[model samples]
Target chain A: MPDAIDFWFSTGSTYTYLTVSRLEQVEAATGMRFNWRPFSVRAIMRVQNNSPFANKPVKMGYMWRDIERRAGLYGLPVKVPAPYPLQEFDRANRVALLGLEEGWGKPYIVASYRRWFVDGQEPGMEPNLSASLREVGQDPARVVGQAQSDRIGGVYGAATDEARRLGVFGSPTFAVKGELFWGDDRLDDAICWLKHGRLVA
Target chain B: MPDAIDFWFSTGSTYTYLTVSRLEQVEAATGMRFNWRPFSVRAIMRVQNNSPFANKPVKMGYMWRDIERRAGLYGLPVKVPAPYPLQEFDRANRVALLGLEEGWGKPYIVASYRRWFVDGQEPGMEPNLSASLREVGQDPARVVGQAQSDRIGGVYGAATDEARRLGVFGSPTFAVKGELFWGDDRLDDAICWLKHGRLVA
Candidate 1:
C-alpha cells in the first residue's frame, strides 16, 4: 500500500490553494496517496485563540506580494479578491465534505481551492460554486445541499477535532504516519517523511 | 539620524536569538541604530492564535528540530530547555527593558540571546540569568528586583500594548517606518525597507 498523507486544508486558505495544484504531482512522484481532510478554518482559529487577520496590516500587505512572487515561481496565476480572508469558506468547506463522502475528495479540493485562489472567485457564492461543480461534472445543487446535511456537518467537525488532536493550529498542515508538518513550506519535508518513513534528524 | 528599526523580540525565542546576532553585524556593516523593543512572546502568540509550546506537541517538536537545523546553518549551539515555554520571561523581559533604558539594549539583547540559544542555558533560570548578566557587569539581583517593580512592569506592558497597536503578532518582528516584517527570515526585507523606504512591489 502506498503511504497515506492526511492533508488538512481550509478552502479560503491561499497557501492551501498554492499547494493543491502541485500536490497530485508530488503524490504521483512519491507513490503516496493523499487522503483529503477538509476542515473549518474558523474552528482551528478558535482553538488557537486567534482572530483571523488580526493586528496585521503591513504583514498582510507583504503577504499579497509574497504570494504573487510564489505564484509566479510556481507558474500559477494570482488573483487578489476583495474583502480578503473570503468569508465564504463555510459553504466551500461543506461542499468539500460532500466530495469526501462521494470519493471524489482530491479533485473537489483541487477545483475548489483553484477557483478561490487562482480563479479569484468567492467560494460561498452560488454562481461560482455552481460553475466550478459543473465544470467538474458534479451536480452543484445536490453537492451543496448534501454539504449542509447533518452527516456532512459531522465530517467537517470530525476533521477539525482531528486537527486539534494532531496539534495542528493552521492550514496546509500535513501528517504522515502521525508526524505533523505545518506550513506550505514544509510540504517537501512531509513528502520526505512519506518516502523515507522519517525526516532526516 | 539613521533609520530606526524597531525590533520586537522575546527572550526565549531562538529565531529572535539568531536575528539579534546577525542584525548586530548588519548594523555595524550598514550603519543603522535598532530601537530594541522586548515584548511578551505569550501575548504575540495569543494574538496570532498560536498555542503555547505546552499545548502543541507537534509544533513544539517542529520548533525544536527546525531551530536545531537553522542553528547548525548559523553555527550556533542550541539546546531545547526544560519547561519549553519558560514562564519566567516576565523577569527576563524586565531586564531587557532596563537594558533599553540604559541605551545598551542592542548589545544586551545580543548577549542574552547568545547565552540562552548559543550556550544552551535556561534563560529563566536564576543561575543562567545571573551568569549572563554578570558577564555584562550588570547586577542581576538588583535588575531582577527592579524588573518586578510597578514602574518597569508597566513599561513592559506598554511595549506589549504597542506591539499590538503596531499589528505585531510574532517574535523577531521588525518595523521600519511603519512597515512590519515578521519572522527571522524577514530581517533582510526589514533592512531593505529601511534603506529603500519600501519593498519592491
Candidate 2:
C-alpha cells in the first residue's frame, strides 16, 4: 500500500472531466499526491465489448443532464461538442504523456478538458492542442514533436496495459492501496480510503 | 416536482441491495417518503440490448469487490450467493407490491435482501420467500398466492413500464422532482437535491 492515489482517466470521458477539474482542490484539501495517468478508454471498453454511449438513448439523455448539473454544482463550464465521441484522443493523450514527464501534467489535462468540454473544441485538432500545451508553459513545438514520436506510442500503450492489469475498466478510476474505486462519484471515498484505509470491521 | 423520492430497484442487483439496506436510514434522516418501486432489471436491460453481467468479467470482478467494501462501510453483512444474478424477482416484486399495500414494504425489502445477499439463498426460492414475507408479518400463503396472480403480473409490468417512462435504466435509481439519480452512490446527492435543489449559476 503506497501513500499515493493513482488517478487514471481518458481524455474523452465526461466524468473524467469532472475529476480533472476538481483534482487540484481535492489535493490541496487532503494533502495528498496524485500519480496522474492517462489511458485510452476506448481500448479499455473494447476488452469488455462495451461502449459508454452505445446503449439506451433515454439513459444517455439523463446522463447528459446529470453531467450538466454536476458541472453546475462544481461551478465548471461545459458544452458537449457537435460531433460527439470524437475518438480524437491519440494526439492529446500523447501530449499528456509528454506533459507528465515534463512536470506540467495536471495543468495540461485541465486545459485539454476545458478545450473539449467547455469550449466545444475538437480534441487532436490543431491550434487547440498546441495552444493548450503553450498555455501550460510547455514549448508547443517541442512537446508536440515528442508527443507524436514513436516512443510515446509505446509508452501510452503500456499505460493502457497497466490500467487493465489494475482492473480499471472505467475512466476516472482512483486506486489506493491496490483497491480500485471507479467513477467520479467515488472520488471522495477514494481520498478517504487513502487517508484512513478501507472501512473494515 | 413532487416532494417525494421514487426509489427504484431490481431485487437481483447487488447495488440495489446496498441501497435497499440503507433506504430506511435515509428516509429517517431526510424525513421523506419513498415510492418503493420494484421492477425487472433484465426487462429494462433488454430494451438497451445489455445484460448486467455481460462480457465484462473484469468490470464485474471490480463490482463484486466494491459491493463488499460498501457493505462493510454500512455495517451490513453480505455473502454473494452461489450462481448469482438470480432473476427470480417477479414473484418477490409482486409480493413487495402487496407488502407496500400492507404498510410493511421496507421491512419486507430488508428481509428479501438479507435472504439473497446475506443468507446465500436463491430469490423466489420456496422457504426463503415464504420466510421473508412471514418475517415482515405478512400471511405467507396469501401473499404468495397473490404474488403469483395474473393481476399482480399486470401490476408489476406496469411498474416496469413506469420506470422506463421515467428513464430509469439502472437499479437503485432515485427520482426526486422528476430528476433521476441512478446508482446507490447518488442516494446522498438525491437527498441533498431534494433539500437544497440543484446548484445553479
Candidate 3:
C-alpha cells in the first residue's frame, strides 16, 4: 500500500513542511499510503539556476501571507516569518533518509516541521533537530551519528538524483505512475488521479 | 454585484486563460459579479527584474506539464507550447481596457483566451486579437483604432501601477476588498474569503 504514491520533499523547503505535517491525517482519512521520498530539492534548484526567493522581497512577502492563508484553510497551525533559508541541510536530510530506512522517518519529519513552522525554530538547526530526533523515540547521538555515515550519504544522493531524473522541479511533489504533481494545493488532485486517473469529462 | 470582486489579468499570461475562459461558468453558478481589471503584468515584472520562465528551460519544462495537468483538472482544453512571451502586449491590453469600458470586456477576454490557449494562437497578436474583438460584436477597425489613443494608454498605465501598489505579482489575480489572491487555483480560496472571511477551524 505504501508503494501506491511517491511523496518527494526536501527537509528545508517551506511548503514541504505543510505536506509532511499533514500526510498523517491524509493517510488516516483516505486509507492511502505515501512512500516518503525525501531528497534535496535545493540541489536541483541550484542545477537549474533558479532561486525563486533569493533577493526577491515582494515575492517572499507574498509567499509568507499565502502560506498563512493556506495553513488556515488546512486547519494547520503555522508561524510565518519562521526562521528561513537554513544554512546547512546535509545533516537533516541524511537523518531523514536514515529514518525512512529505520521506519521512524514519518514522525521525525512531522516533529521537525512542527518545530520549524509551528514553534518558529529554524529548520535543520541544532538542539531543535536533536530534540526532534528524540521526540520520535530515537537516540539523538546514535541516529544523528549514523545519519552521517557514507552509506546514508550515498542513499541520499541517489534519491535526489532519481527525483531530478523524474522531472521533479520542486519539493512536495507527488508522483503517481511516474507523473509528477507539484505543490501542496495539488494533494487532492494527486489522489484523484491515483483513483480515477486523468482525462475525465 | 460586479463591484464585489475585482478580476485582475494580463492578456498574455498563460494561466490567465484558465480564469478568463471559465469565469462565466463560475459567475453563473454563483451569481456573483467580477470587475474586470486589465493591466500590464509584464510591466511590473520588468521593474522587479524577475522572470520565472526566462533562461530556465527546466522550470519551463515543468511548468508546461503542470499547466497541462491543471487544464485537465479544470476541464479546459489547452494547447501546450502556445506562442509565449508575446512580443507586443501594449496594443492588445489597451483594447482590453476599451472593451471593459464598453461593457464587452468579459466576452472579449474569454474569446482572446480561447484563441490563445485552445487554438494555439499567440496572445495579443493581430488577426487573433482582431478576430477576438469581432467575436463579441465590436468592430475591429474602430475598437482597435480607439484602443491606441493616449487616454487608453493613461488608463492602462494607471491600472498597472495600481496593481503593483496592491502587491499583485502575477496575472489573473482575484482581489476582493483590496486583498490580493494570486494564481488561478486560488480563485475558490478568494471566493471563500469573500463569503466567510478567513480563520475558519
Candidate 4:
C-alpha cells in the first residue's frame, strides 16, 4: 500500500490554499495516497494559548507582502479577503467533511483553494462556491446539505479531536505514517518522508 | 535625519534574537536607526482570531524542526530552552528597557541572542545572561537593578501599547515610517524598504 499522506487543513487559511494547489502533483509523482482531513482552526487555537495575530503590526504588514510575493512566485493571483478571518469557514468546513465521506475530499480541496486563491472568490461566499462546485460537476446544494448533517458533524468533531490528540496546532500541516510536517513551506519535506520512509537529515 | 526603522519585538521571542544579531550591520549598510519597540504577542492574536499554533500536530512538530533548520541556516547553535517560554521575561525585558535608555539596546540584543542561540542558554537564565553581559563589559547586577526602575517599566508599557496600536502580531517585525513587516524571514525585504523607500514590483 502507498504511504498515507494525511492533510490537515482549514478553509480560511491562505497557506492551506497554496498547498492544495500543488499537493496533488506531488502525490501523483511520489505514488502516495492522500487522506484528506479537515478540522476547525478555532478549536485547535484554544489549546495552544497563542492568538494568531498577536500584537505585531509590522509582522502582519509583512505577511500581506510576503504572501503576494509567494503567490506571484507560484504564478497564483492573490486577493485579500474582506472581513479578514472569513468567518464563513463553518459552512465550508462542514461541506468538506461531507466530501471526505464521499471520497471527493481531494477534488473539493483543490477546487475550493482554486476558487479562493486563484479566482479571488471567498470559500464562504455562496454564489462563488456554488458555481465552483457546479463547474466540478458536483451538486452544490446537495453537497452543502449533506455537509450539515449529523454524520458530517461527527466527522468534523472527530477530526478536530484527533488533531488535538496528535498534538497538531496549525494549518497546512501534513503527516506521513506518523511523522508530521508543518507549514506550507514544509511540503517538500513531507514528500521526502513519504518517499523515503525517513526524514532527510 | 534618516527615516527611522521600527524594530518590533517581544521579550521572549527567538527569531528576534537572530534579527538583533544582524541589525547593526543592516543599519550600517542601509544607514537607518532601528527604533526598538517591544510588543505583546497576546494582544495581536485577539484581533486576528488566530492562535499562535493553529491545531495540527504536524504544525507543532514542524515548528521545532523548522527552528532547528533556521538555526543551521544562520550558523547558530541552539538548544530548546527549559520550561519552553521562559517566564522571567519581565526582568529580562526590564533590563532591555534600561539598555534602550543607555543606548546599548543593540549590543544587549546581540549578546542576549548569542547567549540563547549560540550558547544555548535560556532567556532569563542569570548565569548565562551575566556572562553575556560581562563579555560586553556591562555589569549585569547593576544593569538588572536599573531595569527595575519606573522609567524603564513605563517605556516597556508604552512600547507594548504602541505595538497594539500599530497592528503588530508577531516578532522580529520591522516597520519603516509605520509600514509593518512581520516575521524573521522578512528581514531582507524590510531592509530593502529601508534603502529603497518601497518594495520593488
Ranking by DockQ: 2, 3, 4, 1
Q: Evaluate model 3 with DockQ and give the value.
A: 0.53
In order, the B-chain TM-scores come to 0.87, 0.92, 0.93, 0.82
The sequence of per-residue lDDT tens digits that candidate 1 reaches over residues B1-201 is 467788898887756767877776778987877778888867766656644455655556667766665555566666754335665777778888887797665666677677676565567565677887777777878877777899998999999988978877678888887677778866766777788765442
Tens-digit per-residue lDDT, A15-86, candidate 3 = 887788788899898878999998988899998877878877787888888888888778889889788787
Choose 3 or 4, whichever is better by DockQ: 3
Q: Can you tell me which runs of candidate 4 are displaced by over 4 Å?
A: A1-5, A22-35, A46-73, A83-91, A97-107, A114-125, A145-158, A176-179, A185-201, B1-5, B21-66, B97-107, B114-125, B149-162, B188-201
Per-residue lDDT over A86-141 for candidate 4, one digit per residue giving the tens place of the 0 to 100 score: 65787788877777677776677677767776566678566667876776678987
Query: What TM-score between 0 and 1 does chain B of candidate 4 receive?
Result: 0.82
- Per model, the share of native interface contacts recovered reads 0.05, 0.77, 0.49, 0.23
Candidate 3 colliding pairs? none
Query: Arrange candidates by TM-score, highest first: which order?
Result: 3, 2, 4, 1
lDDT of each: 0.72, 0.81, 0.83, 0.69
Task: Please report the candidate that would top TM-score against the real structure.
Answer: 3
Best first by lDDT, ranked: 3, 2, 1, 4
Q: Which stretches of candidate 1 lie over 4 Å from their true place?
A: A1-4, A21-33, A44-76, A79-91, A97-108, A118-120, A145-164, A192-201, B1-6, B12-91, B97-125, B136-166, B176-179, B185-201
Candidate 2 docks at the CAPRI level of medium
lDDT string for model 2 (B38-111, tens) is: 88767888878756566778878888888988888988898853347675767777777777877887788788
